[model samples]
Target chain A: MRPILLSGHTRALTQVKYSKDGDIIFSVSKDQIICAWYAANGERLGTYHGHQGALWTVDVDPTTTLLASGAADNTIRLWDVKTGKLLKTWDFGTAIKRVEFSPDGTQLLGVTERRQGHLSTIVVYDIVLDVEAEQADEHSLRIVCEDSKATVAGFSYGSKYIISGHEDGSVTQWDAKTGELLDSAQIQEDDMQITDLQWSSDRTYFITASKDKTAKLVAANDLRVLKTYVADTPLNSAAITPVKDYVILGGGQAAMDVTTTSARQGKFEARFYHKIFEEEIGRVRGHFGPLNYVAVDPQGKSYASGGEDGYVRLHHFDRGYFDFLYEVEREAEQANL
Target chain B: MSKVAGRTDWAEEEDEDSLALPPPQITKNKDGTETIVSYRIDENGKKVKTTRRIRKTVMKQVVNPRVAERKHWSKFGEEKGKPVGPQSDTTSIAENIVFRPSSNWKTNQSEEKNPIDKQKATLKDAKIKCRICSGEHWTSKCPFKDTMAPEGENAGAGAGTGAEEESAAPGLGPSNSSYVPPHLRGKSGVTGERMGGGKFGQERDDLATLRVTNVSEFAEEQDLRDMFTRFGHVTRVFLAKDRETGRAKGFAFVSYADRTDAARACEKMDGYGFHHLILRVEFAKKPTT
Candidate 1:
């Protein structure tokens, strides 16, 4: 399969995501710009250019009209996706590490970085869907990360609970409405930090990629680990494909960290692992440097990856991807017939 | 056409609006295809014509209204006022990759590497090839082995380097293979020497060979042999010919079974007129190399 390469970012890419319909792709980089591209081709839709500092995270509301981004400037800005107009900006004490829109378009959650005597916190805001309406200046609820700073946080299905992966290898769940701690579990290694957390299609379970070179599927309600997929290199991001029972993991060592490692050891690839079996099936290799993020299309048509080389590659699945079947799976299909 | 109301630069005065080439022609074919022919002036001031035939098919895909509306939205930010389509500077297509997945994909990858291991899996289906006749049999069992000299010496290789080694005296053919004739097989140094050390051995003595010159270009090896056979039992007759013209090169070698007989023929052949030219005959000297 041929991959369409989008080279709009001037610096390493931090995140790339597909719209709900899988027609648009939004990417944010450390170069302080957010780019939107049409998924059918590599045509660029537009760019949002109001971030003062390097951007770290970006998220789109369910309706795809409102776009939110958090940056190292310690501010989260909202923008109109169609016109790239700046709508609102919320200031914080520290830089926001992660930002995610709740399942419903009414709320937004952000994880603030712990720095300069400011405690890491998870804050939620009531978002107004109308572009002309004024947004609330104050946060509706805030939860202090007392033990470990949360690196990633997302609202559960129906906005019931908020799940956060911490820097200390623990995943904690908090009440979405009351902002109270509920359940916490050490899902990863003792001190290995979790780098990324992503939810399944239904949002009942989520996968967390950690510095321990493994990603775990954890339930959203009780925070119990279900399946663990181990990899050779430290993973930076992980995404579960919707149609196929496969999980794509993106990771590698930064070339500067270990100068003596071989190119293969610095695994610059997106590995596909069978979700239930935890066996690595295949890998797609193209990035010059380590992959920073991987996002699959919600409609199961394609997947896109952002790399430290400052390029986003969109790959559409070939017929072989859908035709592949395990022996046992083939037998079960025949029995059904 | 450009929107330049007036030209400010004198050297570029509205030449871009002028067209010296012919207009493109389009034709509809009976097979539901369109043929388009276009002409242009190339960089070398040469007129070039291009023709293309294409079939058009309509594909319908129903998408959500929100997505349909978003597709027509105007471009903004850095791409403002730009035409619709992928920009060349920011977008490109990468090379194709084969990513077929299988349960035993790991084993499939490692098997392609070490060829010796793959040889075992294919050994039962392997086919035999005869080096001499290229038939399906072993080289030693080929019917053309004795008649063809194993098909290697017939290539006109000039002078083989292995001949300089003289590893086993001189033989009828180059020792490219280790196959010894049925006579020489299982024989040690004593029995081999009695047979004159090689296939040609004592019968191929260089002393009994005579080099004949001033021969006619139309002369054949058999003609030279007939003329010299009256004086001695002719062992072998070799004629040098032109590779391109395939004509005799005015020289031939005639070997006799006995040196005394070769001397008689050399004396008789010298100064003998043939083809209106006098012939010269002398003992053939072995190459020092």
Candidate 2:
């Protein structure tokens, strides 16, 4: 497979996302610039440049009209994806760590960093979902994490529940409308923080990547861990593929200790694991530094990865990726036929 | 250096200016390729003519209407007012990687000697261009080696066995490591033997081996080993064969554990008749510079 390298970021990339149609890729970096690219050819669509501090997270709405990003500047900002205009900006007391839009694109959520006497919280706002409309200033619901800070949060299917992965290695399910905690499941060891949480195509189940060097798949409604994928290094991001029963994970040695270890020893690669078997299938190695995030296309034809080395690699899968099958999987297909 | 197309020496400046130049032209060939001929005057006031053949084909694909419209969206923010298409400063294609995920991908990476075999396969298909038409190749393969004087400074470079004396000349001593045309490296065949073929004594085996020629095409390594083992201990027997057909190419090499045994076999096999032809046997000579 030939990879297309996107080289617009001057600093390490923090996250990348594909549009609902899987055509455009939006990436944010610590360099304070957000870039949009055509996923098929690596062509730069445009750049969004208003954040004053390093960007921590970015998310595109399901309609592909509005883009949301959280930054260390103590605010979450929304931008018009087509014209690159800043539509709305929500101020917070603490820097926002992660931002995501609900499945129906009617609500947006932002996770705040815990610092300076402020307990971390997840806040939700009613989105107007139009480029020309005015967004409300007040948050519709705010869930305070009184025990341990939440690092990553997202909405469940039909907006029935809100699932958040926390700094204390627990996944918590909360009532989306009332902001009440329903259930909690400890997903990782040693109080390691969850770095990323991404939803599957249906949003009923999700994958969480943690600093404990493992990624886990959990049911959203009950907060029950289903499958666990153990990797060699601390994982920064995890993504579930749509059409294929596979998951892609990205991570390596932390950026601070990267100078002490070589790339080979750093384990700077995206590991692919079988969703049911929980066995590693293969790894794609390219980044000289740690891989920060990986996002699979909605159509499951390709994937994109952002790295600490300031590059986004877009890889289109070859025929072999779709052809590989385990003995049992092949027999199952034959039985179906 | 001497390969520059328009570098005329200062002494030939008058003669170069006395010639008239022709206009550039482009012609379309019947095979759907275009032939472009262009001329330009260089900094040295000499003219150069260049020829290029190029083929162009257009591909079409049906895409989603929204994606098709988004491709024409105007550049904004930092890319404001920039022209269409991917700017060179940002996007690029990286090297191709062979990614075939099998059930045993994790175990398959451990025992790979396949890359070296792939390189050897590529070497077999490498084109041999002549450099008198190409000196990057062997002089014997160049049709113009005996007829043409090499271009520019290399004109005085010898064309035959005199390549040895030319390489040892005093002028080339300092920058000899830079590049030397292949024809100037002599026909000693030393450079060719530097790589492998090590199963038999590519290194020191020549000290106790014999080269047998005029052997029948039907000759096998076992037959040669049987014939030569009568003298003493035969270490190895190698019969050069055609790759497609398993027949020998009329030659073989027999190695002995002792040099005296090799000498006795060479004497007995020299005038021996085998399969309607007399054999010529001699001590295998080692390559030397």
Candidate 3:
């Protein structure tokens, strides 16, 4: 179990996506560069320079060979994993806030950053199936409302629906096929922004992390409110286990002394995986910075995370305590992704 | 002696002079109390200012240790079922799994915790390198090469091996200096080194077509009609199924009955959105049967 150290891009890596087969990991940073690495060894593969601005999100098709990326540059670009070639670029005239590939790997979903007086909207597109074709008005679906601002954080089940976590702290479920509004609700009034969204393995429920330092579960079928788990610290990222029984949350202690606190040097007083039953399962408490992201593997056995302190740490539960495996300093700039 | 009345006048002048004298000084004593210290503001007139200092004692707040005791999931099983105890040394197994989306969590029973017993934690730590000769792995293809170099060797195995040697030493020195094959390396152990491969050792060819199923027998026709009309205007959908099973092949031979429809649908709906599903719309195969 040797942890591989990746050190090249110079800054924190904000976004990372695993290939369909989980063989490759693609990551991007605030440094405005994209890197592909062999998942197992953390070996640097190649870097793609497409977005002039920092990349916010990157998603690999769950079943296909296409890779979609959304960035601060206000354009979404399709890339071929084999050749690292850019296929097509679509301009939404606004910065892309989130990018995701549907469950079956057929469509690409992108959300826009906030605009003045107008709500954010999500764009759905059908990527040209043939690798050699070129046309802009191909298969496409666009869903936007005048007063609604939505950031589609992640997808659920087979991509039949999406849980859009808005900057306003609202979570809306949309029927992906019909572009109809399924159900919408807010955890609190413009107080908690859903930083991370994940679906249960069975597609039965989805969980969200709010700025209010709590993770709530939502029933997907009827959009019913489920249990809400509060963290001791402010929340930055959250993930649900593939088995659907647990969740992993990452963040740091809320600043107790606001006036004397340093924004850039926050500490992660606690990071842990909690059982959905409101039970604390395992925790890591040594990080002297805020946690940026937490990711569970496909099998739900072990999880990995990255923090503002430039460390990618792996944690595993031994009998009843979490044992730290390795912590690697990812020398890339990770900001919003 | 005769000027007794003049003496009274002189006495009045002396009283006015005494009014201009300074006040006395105040200071603290060794017993934590205050005292007056005498000082002079000028050589002739006695004037003073106090440098008195005061001290106050404060009591520290204390919390009941029992009330502060609370337990957490990360430290739950390791410590007693209280919050403010010594943090436990162990954690539940559910702590490490990656997260996914769920739909059944409304019920309190939806989430469960797996209890960790006396099982020893099997920490995963592996060097990403060759199993045979030690070398840097980013450029190696020899399945089994050493990650760390042995004493006295350059740790570099230069190119190419015979078929016999390659077969015998399935896990030998690294090969291929130019490209890194994506398919390799075992993740933590649940999935074998090739858990993602076909059930058997056979590799599926890149051009192999998938069989689609589940839609009505005319699913082929309906999809073709619906797509051509919406994709930008004309054509067809060919539903491909298995020959003997009569099941949808999980894929359809979609054709734009019109070439332009085919071209446009290819452009617009190639990756069309569906409920819980995203479809990869492509050109259908011609009916040869």
lDDT of each: 0.83, 0.84, 0.54
Worst 10 residues of 1 chain A by lDDT: A255-264
**Model 2 Cα shift for residue B258 (angstroms):** 28
- How far in Å is the alpha carbon of A287 misplaced in model 3? 4.7
| TM-score computed on alpha carbons, candidate 3 | 0.47
A-chain TM-score per prediction? 0.98, 0.99, 0.82
Estimate how well candidate 1 is docked, as a DockQ score: 0.53
Order of models, best TM-score first:
1, 2, 3
Angstrom error at residue B112, model 1: 5.7
Residue A23 error for model 2, in Å?
0.8
Q: Which candidate is the best by TM-score?
A: 1
What DockQ score does model 2 reach against the true complex?
0.49
Ranking by DockQ: 1, 2, 3
| lDDT per residue (tens digit) for residues A122-154 in model 3 | 788876554576635444666674444665555
- Residues A60-163, candidate 2, lDDT per residue (tens digit)? 99989999999999989999999899999999999898999999999999999999789999999999989999999999999999999999999999999999
lDDT string for model 2 (B72-154, tens) is 88888878887887788999988987776667766676456368777898999876644343323564764445643333223
List model 3 lDDT by residue over B1-289, tens digit each. Answer: 6597789878877666566544555666787766664444566665554555555457563523321221111211112233432212211112233322222322332234222321222212334433322222332553222232232222223122222223222222243223334554342121222235432111111011111223344344465556556743221233544545665555554322234444555667555554334667543322111
- Native-to-model Cα distance after best TM-score fit, residue A289 in candidate 1, in Å: 1.1
| Model 2 TM-score, 2 decimals | 0.67
